[model samples]
Target: MINQLLLRFKLLKDDKTLIIVMTLMALGLTLVFSSSMSGNYRPEVMLVDSDNTSESREFINELKLSRLLRYTETDEANAIKNIETGMSIGGLVIDQGFSDMMRNGKEINLSILRSKDSIELIQLRSDVQTTAFKFMSKFKTADMTVDIIKGEGFKVVEDELFEETYALSTYYWRYRNPFNLNSQVMDAQKDWAYNPMIHYLIGFTLFFSTFTIVFVGSDILKEKQQKTWQRKLVSPVSNTVIISSLLIVTFIVGMLQVGIIVLIGNYFLDINWGMNIGLMLIVFAAFVYAFTAIGLVVAGLAKTIEQLGAIVPIILVSSAMLGGTMWPLEIIQSKILLTLANLMPHKWAMQIISQTSAYGLNVSNFITSVLVLIAMGTVYLLIGLKLSKRHVY
Candidate 1:
């Protein structure tokens, strides 16, 4: 066991370049992505064309004028498909008699289908209604003017004159409309003041930390490949010490890597990690332990270091993207993506970081995230131990 510990340390000492590169990658990516965090994200709406008339075309154009939504014109079947598949937050269906309804000055309802209820969907509904009402009123005004002309005994083509009147009204609505409608979405959830530097610093820390931990944990697989594991099993020390030492060494190395990132975050990036030291310590420990166990689990599953190398990166990168490391989950409207995020350890770690971060968070939510990390770590460790039992003589 002592020999095993020394060999691990010797390997760690020799692999200084990998550790340094990982740290640099984390910090560099944080700086690069932090600037783009405020980039615009418009809700996407699938627009179904049922009328397929000039009136419907103009209305679709009106919908596109809104900067709040990115509308895509699709068939009714496709729109409904996108809505059901979670590819779209919602869909809007134009009535079949939309053009006739406009000509007759009758208001028509736009059908809205929501895949899931969200603030964006609510805002989309309002925008659609506003545009529909504007068109409705414009057509009604044209009808009134045509009626007045008929009453005054003017001999003019009714359809042509009404088209001219409606066109003029639409022009006035665009350039000379006095009512400036600025629609804002007020979300149901409580808002927290987000600090970008803190977020990126925390995010990259969690994301890139997996690289070193996984590589270090692969030493167990390396031992099996070199037949060192068998020799250790036959030694005087119990297998318990050998297993405990591997985890303890990996845990210590992970904590050191975190401390290095903290120092760099504080001094190099000028970030204050907030005053939640106790919460930070426990949560960070849970995060590191969970990932360490995950690495060991990867080790237990793989027959050699080469297999571990191939498996670890995909899991780490994909989990990071899903887990709010690349971006916050609050902006994501897909229920499917959100559900998938919960199954990843990266999500729980990031949630804990966000909760205890500089802006502060709800205590109740913070406790829940922390507990989830602990539970995840405990489960992974047990699974790793179970898998390792197959290798033990």
Candidate 2:
């Protein structure tokens, strides 16, 4: 086994350019794509507060904390003109007497203005609507409390009581929402920070690593070409030993390439892989093993070395693009494409990484993704090993 492993390493050593190119492409494309996709540019959205009341002011303040877009104060005419002229992505408008409308139980007057519907526009609308909903609920609670006081005929200033009660209810709503009972849903929607560098960095790493693992797996065909497999069968070494050794070598070589890319991401690109190092390593391991297993199928399926070289890229890149490697699936409007993406392992891997690293999502949220990756690897490994036994070469 040791000799076989060394022999495999010797073979891989001769292909140093393959390793170097894969590593460089992973990091290089991340920088290029991220820059093209507004790596650090957060779109600015205009805010029109005609009411200029405390409620309206607080609503605008809430918008500033949103990760989706930056909110700035401006007039309705200015907001419309900029959106029309393409200077702004979108705008939110608060009609006159917005607070009175809320307190008086009249229509909730709010409007969203945009050039067209985009992901950012949708998120901005959601943020504006959600904020208004919270204020509406808080006022409802205040109104309920004040009505009860009025019925009791208490000698209290009604306006002053409503103000105090409204202020106190804000703390209650913030500290304890109905969804807090379930820990999973508590902060699920909180602070989904988007960085194109982080997105493309993880994306390209996953994309290019497939080339490394699959090419390494193709060494089985190489061994056949050099008559190494036939020579080994006549020796004391068993077939199991030969296959196991090759698997280990493939895993180690591929991991080193991935590790180098990750290091570049950390030191040079300033990417924080995630908070939990242990889990992140598991993610990397599971990803390699899954595709390494898939490579077995590739090796078994391709009848010639030329076919192996050509078929692997088409399969891998298509999977990557379908899995949201180039651009986010959120922007892809086609329902068929969205549904088909569920079949791609890269989709689950990207989902788990992006959520955990950027949003600080808990492990429980992505356990299913990890499990699916392992299951796919195991199933593919079995099929590949079986199919390789019948190879003509």
Lowest summed lDDT window (length 10), candidate 1: 185-194
- Candidate 1 CA-lDDT value: 0.79
Per-residue CA lDDT of model 2 for 1-393, tens digit only, reads 788888888888767888889889988888887776565577889889989998777767766766667888999999999999989889888888887887779878788888875657766778777877787787888889999988998878888998899888877777766445533435333333456588788788889888988988878876676777678777899888887887888788777887787777767876775545567667778888888888888888887788888899899999999998776677678899999898788888888888777777576857888888899889999998897686455
lDDT of 2 at 257: 82
Q: Candidate 2: worst 10 consecutive residues by lDDT? A: 182-191
TM-score of 1: 0.60
What overall lDDT, based on C-alpha atoms, would model 2 receive against the true structure?
0.80
Please tell me which predicted candidate would have the highest TM-score against the true structure.
2
Error of 2 at 172 (Å): 20
**Deviation from native of the Cα of residue 174 in model 1, angstroms:** 25
